[model samples]
Target: MVQRQQVVMFEIKKASEAEIAERGDLADKVADALARAGFAVHRDVNDASGALGAMAWADPADDSGGGVFVRWLIDPAFSRAAVQSVQQGDVESAAFKHFSTVTEQMYAALLAILTSAGFQSEDADDDMSPYTIRVKG
Candidate 1:
């Protein structure tokens, strides 16, 4: 079977105009936090292929054949981050299931980390459809 990637988008909810004005700095703070938690931060496409803004990858030591990638969107009007799993080679049903389970665990852990870093975050939907996280600034 073909492997499919799972994505979790994080949208920042600005608390004030000052927060909105400091979106770039906020993005950098998030990147720093993730880096401290063992993610490799990439600031350019050259650092990470096809990346439009900042990108980060979970440590290779945590890879279960599929690693997690995080893209930090620095747009002033709509700052956000997107976390996703790297698609792996085609595999059997059992392997695919294992990958999905592991990916979910990784997502959960990431959410916890973000929240612990003082970002008020929650899943956009109760059932987690679309896998979006609303982060309060």
Candidate 2:
């Protein structure tokens, strides 16, 4: 049987004007970290507002009992240049191509980046939920 595991979740909030400038760079770093830790990362965007984001997941081929996943959403307030950068696309593609089952390292790296940037952790309670990219097997 296939079971899904929640490794980590970040309730990312909208970025302010000044923080928008750094969103692209931070996204790139997170994507790179996920790739290095062995995940198939996918770059995504919000259709309505065009917010950028990425998702990474553990591969099933490795015979791990459960799956691990991580995803994040960039603040919609970010500029178009940062939201639609060629570098971001390339980095995301490269990360997506890396498929391995090692999930702990990816979780640690991703958690570090998000927490360092002051992104909120997921709320166990529903009433306090915030904007986020949720990942699950």
Candidate 3:
């Protein structure tokens, strides 16, 4: 039986700006991270004003924090596995550890990818949440 393990949901939030720009930087970062992690991920975006800017721009890492709004969401299934980590009682450790094991040192890689692209990432103080990413520009 394919175990029905919970999978974390991730997505880049809709970029809503009175000004118009595709705002696909977050998606690019996600693709880089996932690619390095060996997941063939992709991204796409649209301006709330009906502006179709960057189409299919590395759609990966979902609904998360960046630049006063954008965010890099980690999947919940992965998040829980990270929490209940075999290590137990050390969720933060497990969160990092879990993704690390799956993607061969993915956390740092993702962090680097996000930061280099003007996005800042912070691990949650509480293990119950996923890491947050903020964009500088």
TM-score to native of every candidate shown: 0.45, 0.30, 0.34
* lDDT tens readout by residue for model 2, 13-131: 44444444344444455456655655445644323244334463332322222123344434454333343544577525433333111233444556665555454433122233222
Candidate numbers sorted by TM-score from highest down:
1, 3, 2
Candidate 3's clash total is 22
Error of 2 at 53 (Å): 12
Write one digit per residue (lDDT tens) for candidate 3, span 1-137: 68888999975555455211434555455455545655544342343223221112422233342232222334556655765764566646847676656543444455566566545544423344234333333
Instruction: Give the per-residue lDDT of model 1 (tens digit) for 1-137.
Output: 99989998975443454433454455566678778988656634345444433353322221221122343423332211112122444444454555455546655765787789997656545253334344444
Give residue 22's error in model 1 in angstroms. Answer: 2.4
How far residue 91's Cα lies from its native spot in candidate 1, in Å, is: 11
lDDT of 3 at 127: 45
Residue 119 deviation, candidate 3, in Å?
A: 6.3
Candidate 2 root-mean-square deviation in Å: 18.2
Where in model 1 is the C-alpha error above 4 Å? 1-20, 42-92, 124-129
Clashes of each: 0, 0, 22
**CA lDDT of every candidate:** 0.49, 0.41, 0.44
